[model samples]
Target: MDMEKEMFDIIHTSEFSIFSLSQLPHDDNSLLLGYEGKVKSFDGRTGKIIDLWEMHEQRVNTIDVHPGNSNLVATCSADGFVRIWDLRCLGKEQPKSIKEVAHNRAVQSAYFSPTGNGLVSTSTEDTIRIWGGPHFENLSIVKHNNKAAGRLSSFSAIWGWNDSYIFIGNIQRAIDVISTENNITTPLKSEYMTNVPCRFATHPYKEGLLACAGGGKLFLWTKM
Candidate 1:
């Protein structure tokens, strides 16, 4: 199917290139979008800007909505910071709270745990940091040396089964699994793997299943 040719609707937006976008978990009518140093929420159906604010010193990297609370959102940035926003105060000019200097280099991505009680962020500095609570207090940090190339090919971390582990790719041809309980990291062994995986995703409904991509190739792993 050609989606562009069979489109149902399209709503033009402001003239800035969006770096990342996330829809509120429970709201089909709203969307959160990030661009250069700023974040905005818009009416998904009408393309109307509901709120706007500058929360980063550089380009915003990614935005993730809390799974349990649709009003809560997390955004990471090229300025090495992560911020928590409350959509209840959507018109405010600043984030409700922030973790200043959350990373030493550009933060590539941030995701809230499926339980919405933990937040994890990855950076170009070869580190992953975890925070606890809906308020996002810093909890632990895991450092690695995956010096893979290219920002477009950068790695992302995601919470895996039971929110007990975080899965990420390293410079080596293997995935690194970090325990959320004790901040320990171990490599995933498999018959097939993606070398220097740049991005990966966990199956939404299937436990221990993952898809990884890098170097023009993709690999799927089952049962961790």
Candidate 2:
């Protein structure tokens, strides 16, 4: 027996490989993409370029949308920086990044907090950074091992249900929770965990429920 497989080209305008992309809020057709060291917006439904601009000196690793503000987005890059951009300033301005920081040697990813009031970034330089306040000048850097997980998923400092706690994996085969308020590190270890939890996800509506995956293993955690 033979099984037929088919593939369709949904986008044709972009000649370069897209590293990361995010759909603009409130508009299903609008999309933002990071490719060839540039930030670009294209019509998702039509596959037409809406706009393009030079964004970073190196590859953009991730594009994250603000949880509260549709107009705000964040991008992390191997250029060692994380920048915050305003979607509202699209055609009116070039280089719409309102805030940016030289986080590390290579930032793996950046994410806005659940409230959109704070930002966090994970870097390959073995550090986790937190930025907040009006100017985003209030910064705290926590030293941690964030090296690439060989043959496994790398670690990302993910926010829990709220903006106060960040969940990440440690070399001790346990989960580490970093407090945003005081910049403290706490470990969550269990006898059942056999491997490191490199990637994380928290229930948006649940307070303590957490999940992490690494080495093709998943662990669900809850405060006892």
Candidate 3:
């Protein structure tokens, strides 16, 4: 990959009242910018504010687009809610609908399933909840870690090679290989980095090579 090439041509720049950025799927040319309790979609080419949607009555934390389909995206807020949007039907005579109350707490990550049929999100409650459907309905909940007071520090990321497996990450910087066929979650061999992993990505064309980064460091690994 040419790191020198511009990713998203920074179509717009605005002040946000939040902590992080909620980006749309890379394949698409749109970005969802969250600020002070609302969400807006910006054009990736011209940096024009194309569409806007209200997600919460309070501040929002993050937004994420679906991996397979760019039309669908997810958002989480400080008000402890996760919402999904279908951008395809926006601003029509009868536009698409948004799903609110998707989660119970301040969500950390709201991610779509690799197959685009379902989604998974993590909360401050220390539980990972999975939802189904392109419409996004509740499906299953995975509770493995203990909850702590005053915002427990946790990191949860998912990597989907296919519908069969999703690699999950934890605060200790270790990963769990989740088998979607049987819902079996197994921890992978630890990388032993200096800090916990904050991001995950796979090779564009190679199936076994994977990359992860955290704490100002990057690491690449290949499956044998």
lDDT of 1 by residue, 1-224 (tens): 34779856666456888999987766778887899998887886777897788778789889998887777778899898888777676556555553444677888899988898888889889888888864666578888764676653778898885678898887767889899888888987665663567788888888878888888889888882
Can you write out model 2's per-residue Cα lDDT over 88-183, one digit (the tens) per residue? 775534575888788649888898888888889999899999988876788899999887556766678988878889988987789989999898
Model 3 agreement with the true structure over 19-87: per-residue lDDT tens digits: 445566553666677777777767767768777666566776667777777777777766778777777
**Backbone clashes, each candidate:** 0, 0, 1
Whichever of 1 and 3 has more lDDT, that candidate is 1
lDDT of 3: 0.65
* Top candidate by lDDT: 2
Runs off by more than 4 Å, candidate 1: 1-14, 92-101, 150-152
| TM-score ranking, high to low | 1, 2, 3
The CA lDDT at 142 in model 1 is 87
Q: Candidate 2, which ten residues in sequence have the lowest lDDT sum? A: 1-10
Evaluated at residue 68, the lDDT of candidate 2 is: 79
lDDT of each: 0.80, 0.83, 0.65
Badly placed stretches (over 4 Å) of model 3 are 1-11, 18-29, 67-69, 88-96, 133-135, 146-154
Query: Which candidate would rank higher by TM-score, 2 or 3?
Result: 2
Per-prediction TM-score to the true structure, in the order listed:
0.86, 0.85, 0.75
